[model samples]
Target: MLQAFESAAFAAWPAQQSLDLLGWHLRLDRGYTKRANSANATAQSLPLTASDVQAIENHFRRSGLTPTFRLTSFAPIEDSDRLLDACGYRACDESLVMTRSLAGFVDGSEIAFAPDAAAWLDAFAHASGKRGADQAVHLEILRRITAPCAWAVHASDGPSPACGLGVLVGDQLGLFDVATHRDHQRRGLARMLCGGLLGWGARRGAQTAFLQVVAANSPAIRLYESLGFEIAYRYWYRVPTT
Candidate 1:
């Protein structure tokens, strides 16, 4: 699972495009570059320190980039939160890392994976409240998906309902960006899409699959936990001060 997490992080880093390491804290230029995004600090065997945080902040400031930090799988590090508080970095949000073993995932039904980019974007916009310039972010995501990487999307009848994206890395699957249109909620489209992704991962020999969800999203958390996923870790995001 650790290796899989690292692999996913590295794969995502290129999209962010550049990175710098400060002990355990990875600071990315140009809005938290891709390389730094891949740093699974908490997943590492060693612990991170306050100096690491300072180093990353220094690197970001020197690079003339806004200081953004993402702590992945960042469990308790001795005085980690204190360091952030000392450095003027405030907690932005927290997310839960949920994992599920795929030993019993079965391919029960065929869910139509979205093949059209326009349709996928429409669904994304409806679910995420992101439109206009923010929609450009989907282009990078589409590039990754159409690169023929392992991804799946299920649409509803008449129009596309919700969408789920999953990426497979070695023996694990990373599920990301599961969104459902407001009107399409309560119909279990998200579950079907998630189940389909799990099935896809299982077929490819993924023993476990994991995803991150906002800690405040109780519905999503409940769904995942009910599907046999457990909270593996909690991560927080923060931005460094000048």
Candidate 2:
């Protein structure tokens, strides 16, 4: 089931495009977030021999992207971590994949679906603190998702906006781009957005809600737990030192 989400999340947030190399899904989205650009090696069938590793690096290098791999608990290739370590790849950004059932949901009035990509981008940028290629890459990725999407914002009565979030890939309703405004921290806006989005998904016939949060983020993890979400699995990125 956890493995299913790793694939579902990838499907929901696809790269600008991707390639299948030796049963591995090599996602390419310029040089944006690791989640988008890194290859998912959970399904690798080959032994990840030295030549295979070098070829993977060369491919990403030529593609103008750093070689990266997203490693999960169920990766087929054993010793992937040792191989990555020997190759000067460091593990980073360990994150938890969480899920919750949608039984008693409350429709959130403070949250609304983004009318257009521009509006969605505005709130997304504010919460995530990303722009330029970093931001543009995600906008393109979001467009690739054909599922019913809800780009939500925490509407504030005052002038200052609180935060933003996105619920793409329905039924599963994978949550991504969750962020809080830089100026607004520890204000519970994220909690509001999360509740609102989950309820919003429930109304759309979504039965399960899933999201990825950095494991190091204690506050965020605590928040999710308080909301009845439990960790399903975890993943991390292996990136080249250079």
Find the 10 residues in a row with the least total lDDT in model 2: 158-167
Best by TM-score: 2
Q: In angstroms, give how far residue 195 of model 1 lies from its true place.
A: 0.5
Tens digits of per-residue lDDT, candidate 1, 58-98, equal 66677666555566654444465566667787766688878
Instruction: Please give me the total number of clashing residue pairs in predicted model 2.
Output: 0
Which residue pairs of candidate 2 clash?
Answer: none
Give the CA lDDT, 0 to 100, for residue 135 in model 1.
57
lDDT of each: 0.64, 0.76
For residues 68-148, write the lDDT of model 2, one tens digit per residue: 988786666657678888989998999999998887677554765567666788777766676676567667776777767
